[model samples]
Target: MSMKNLDRHNRWRNKTVAFRVSPEEDEQLEIFVKLSGLTKQDYITRRLLEKEVVVQGNPRVYKALRDELAAVLDELRRIEAGQGVNGELLDTIHMIATILNGMQEEIAYGN
Candidate 1:
C-alpha cells in the first residue's frame, strides 16, 4: 500500500487515553483484564469508547429478583438494628455486587 493509504489507515485506528486509578481498583481491573484476554489499557479504552444497550428484563423475573434483593437488604437492616452484623453476610453481599457489576460491564461493552 502507498504511504498515504497506510497513514489514513493508521488515522482510523483507535487512540489511547491515560488516567490514574486507585490501587484497589487497579487490582480488580487486573482480574478482568486477564479474564477478557485484553491488556488493562485496551480493556479500559474499549470499555470507555463502547456503546451500551440496556434491555428490560422479563417482568416476572425482574420482579422476583428485585423482591429477593429487597428481602436480603431487609434482613441486613434487621441484623444491623438488632445487635450487630455478620461479617460473612456482608462479604457475600460485596461479592455478589462485584459479580453483577462485572456482568453488567461485559454485557454493555463486550464484542
Candidate 2:
C-alpha cells in the first residue's frame, strides 16, 4: 500500500476505549450530542478530555424544588375544591416563584 493509505489504515485500526452507560444516560448523551452540534463519539471524547465544558451541580435540589412545587399545585387544586387557601401554601408558592426567578435571571445574565 502507499504511505498515505498505510497511515490511514493504522489510524483506523487504533483501539477505542469502551464505557458502560445506563439507557437513560445514553439518551441524555444523545440529546447533548445533538444540541452541541457534535457526533456522539466526538462529544464523548471531548467530555472525557474536559475541554470547555460546563458542568452543572447535582439535580437533586432542582428535583426537590420540583416536588415542592407539585405539592403546592396539589394544595391549590384542593383549595379550588373548597378547602380554602392556606398561608403555608402561599408561602411555598412564593418560594418556588423566587427560586425560578433567580434561575431565570442567572440564565439571562449568563451566570
Candidate 3:
C-alpha cells in the first residue's frame, strides 16, 4: 500500500481529485508549475485553495524563468514576422512579470 499523506494542517489527504484539460491547457499548467518552482500537486492545491503561492527563489526557478523568457522572445519575433499574438503567450508574459515583480520587491525589502 502507498503511504498516506497529510497536509500542512495535519489533515489526512486520502481523496483523489482528477480532471481533464485540453493539451493546450495542460501545457499552460506545466509552464506555470515550473515557473512557480513548486511540485505539480502543491501548485494545483494552492491554486485551488486560493492560497498565496509565494515562490522561493532557487536555481531551478531561475532556469525556468530563463527558458520561459527565451520562449517569449521567440514568440515575439514570430509575431513581428506577421504572426498574431496568442493568449497563451500573453499569459506566460504576465505570469513571468508577476514573478519578477515579486522577486524585486523581496530584494528591495531584503527578504
By TM-score rank, best first, the candidates go 3, 2, 1
Residue pairs of candidate 3 with colliding backbone atoms = none
Q: Which structure is stronger by TM-score: 1 or 2?
A: 2
The regions of model 1 sitting more than 4 angstroms off are 1-16, 51-111
**Candidate 3 lDDT by residue in tens digits, 56-102:** 89999999999999999999999999989999999999999999999
In candidate 3, residue 41 scores what lDDT?
92
Q: Relative to the unseen true structure, what is the Cα RMSD of model 3?
A: 1.4
Candidate with the larger TM-score of 2 and 3: 3
lDDT of each: 0.54, 0.61, 0.95
Q: What is the alpha-carbon lDDT for the whole of candidate 3? A: 0.95
Which consecutive 10 residues in model 1 have the weakest lDDT in total? 51-60
lDDT of 2 by residue, 1-111 (tens): 344433323654245689899876675565455434444665676788886533232365466566676777888789888988865566556655666676778799998
Ranking by lDDT: 3, 2, 1
Candidate 2 regions with alpha-carbon error over 4 angstroms = 1-58
